[model samples]
Target: MSEKVRLVILITAQPGRGEEQVAAFERLAPVVRGEEGCLQYDMHQVSGDPDRFVLIEEWGSKAALAAHDVTAHMVAADAASPGFRAGPATVLEISAESVA
Candidate 1:
């Protein structure tokens, strides 16, 4: 079995489009959370920064994460991003590690 996958995505919306982006994510959240491997899928707006947002996600495994990337809703979000986003999202993969 593969390890779980975690990702943090930073998204910046085009000027004056922050609310629209938030609404878009609100619409998308339920669908994504219902996916087979979805564990955590949450979005948070940056404090005092209306144009910035952060998305945190966790998947059952790498394979599950890969499957998510190709979902119809995800594909549509990618296509619509250019209109609302300032640029491509910054995604950071994460994991818990011990140094001790």
Candidate 2:
């Protein structure tokens, strides 16, 4: 098996779209968590920023993460993203070894 991969995704919702974005992520969460190689897929809203959200995800490997990016749920999310996002999402990928 390959090394695990961790991802932190930051999303900023468009004006008046925060609730919609949260709902979309809530719907997508279970589906993502069920995917092969998904170790963790958790979402969080910023404490003071109603428009800001975060997704913390862990996958079995880089390949698994790549596969996830192409999944139907992710595809739909990407398709609907422009309507809800204020700007491009920020994504950071890391590994324990890299941080050590």
Candidate 3:
């Protein structure tokens, strides 16, 4: 078996457009969480900073994550809100070691 893939994304809404981003994500959550290889898909807002958002995704593997990116829901999410003004686009992607 291969290592799992986890993704963290930090994004900021456009000026005065935080609500738009939030609304879009609300629509996105269910669809993202419904993907076959998705172990988890969570959305959050930064404390005291409504415009700052976070996307946490866990996948069965890198291939699964890649496939999720091309799914219709993801496509709509990107088209609706590009996400983040500036930051590490992908916070991290760790490969868990296999049990020997």
The per-model lDDT (C-alpha) reads 0.92, 0.89, 0.74
- Which one is best on TM-score? 1
TM-score list, all predictions: 0.93, 0.90, 0.78
Worst 10 residues of 2 by lDDT: 91-100
lDDT of 2 by residue, 1-100 (tens): 3489988999999977899988998899889999999999998999988889998999988889899999988988899989889988999986536534
**Sorted on TM-score, highest at the top, how do the candidates line up?**
1, 2, 3
TM-score of 3: 0.78
The regions of model 2 sitting more than 4 angstroms off are: 97-100
Cα error of candidate 1 at position 47, Å:
0.3
**Higher-scoring candidate on TM-score, 2 or 3:** 2
| lDDT (10s digit) by residue, model 1, range 22-72 | 999989999999999999999999999999999999998889899999999
Query: Every model's Cα RMSD, please?
Result: 1.9, 1.9, 3.6
Q: Report the Cα lDDT for candidate 3.
A: 0.74
lDDT of 2 at 99: 38
Q: Whose lDDT is greatest here?
A: 1
lDDT of 1: 0.92
